[model samples]
Target: MTFTEQLRQENDDVFQKIFTHPFVDGIGRGDVPKDSIIHYVKADFEYLNAFMKIYALSMVKAKSRDDIRFFFDQIGFVLNDEVHPHHNFCDYVGVEYEALQSSSLPPTADHYIKHMMHHAQTGTIAEIYAALLPCPWTYLEIGQELLKTYKPTKSHPFYEWITFYADEEVERITLELRHRLDQEAQDVSQEQKQLIKEAFRKSCELEWKFWEMAYICETWPSEQEASRI
Candidate 1:
């Protein structure tokens, strides 16, 4: 089976859950509350900041200029075209962009960001790719499926967000990166292959939790903090 197919086979449960998650399904139906989506976008903005860092580090790890350029291009798009536009949506949904900027990262977002950064900084190029694949690839897949399920309308709050992931250029980039990672994996030892798969699975798990974190609007526990006064 193709590596991408294997990834789907191994993570089928998460694949199903994420696509069918109430938050995701609601977005497709245009029924998710504006406040709920606003909550999600705020956390997502913080997540994308770290996502760009991983892409930058991966660029340093890449040996080929083409690969390096790919990573660099991803960073540019995520920061400039992909993620930043959410701020406009946030404003429309009652989530202030400046407020999200000042806010500290919540518990789940902090842990997930740290995990991705750790792998991105320390992992081999292929490993870094494995760790980073779930977010973009899954989002792209979700976007494609949702576009089929519900035709885009300007009235739907997430139309632009949904449309971004489904863009042909973005889909092309995602597939190209996936093929590159799978090709890189072909020469690695079985142990290393397992490690890469574990990274893939763990990253998928984090993606799953991130959605839950948004659904619940998870925050750092106030009572858990030590009292200074």
Candidate 2:
């Protein structure tokens, strides 16, 4: 099996947890509260900004023109293509996309972004890819899983979000990145490979936490609560 396949197999438990999470179930059922999704969209909008920065870091670290181009394409993908779902969410809930731009990253998103930034700043390209892989990869998996049981139509509140991630074009693009990571892994040392696995695992764990955060509308304590603590 390929490296991506191996990573997926090892992290299946976390993926299963994400698949069964209340946030995901709610999305599939079309009953997730607007407040929860709004919280998630605002946080994720900030997260996507950090994601682009990490890709920029990776582009700087890339050795070859092709590698640089890959990162460049991905940054463009996130900037141009990924935001449409957020727009859809905003439209459904009557939130302005511009407002999301100014929103703070919630705790879970902050942690996940920091995790990827750490690897992007200090790790090898393979490790950077490993760190970043789970975001899009798992979304693809979630979309696939949701499709198996839920048919999203125009009436579905999350139809755009569900279909955007589940699109054949998106699956194709995501798998291309997965295959690229596997190729990057082919020549890495065993120690580096372990680091890659650890990065991948942590990101997978964080992905699940992200869903939980949105489900509960997790946030930082208020100033008074923070001062007391």
- What ranges in model 2 sit over 4 Å off? 222-229
User: How do the residues 177-207 of candidate 2 rate in per-residue lDDT, one tens digit apiece?
Assistant: 7888899999989999999999999999999
Tens digit of per-residue lDDT, candidate 1, span 66-125 = 988888888888878875447546745766666666456768888888878888877788
Point to the candidate with the largest lDDT. Answer: 2
Worst 10 residues of 1 by lDDT: 220-229
Q: What is the TM-score of each candidate against the true structure?
A: 0.90, 0.94
Each candidate's clash count: 0, 0
RMSD of each: 2.6, 1.9
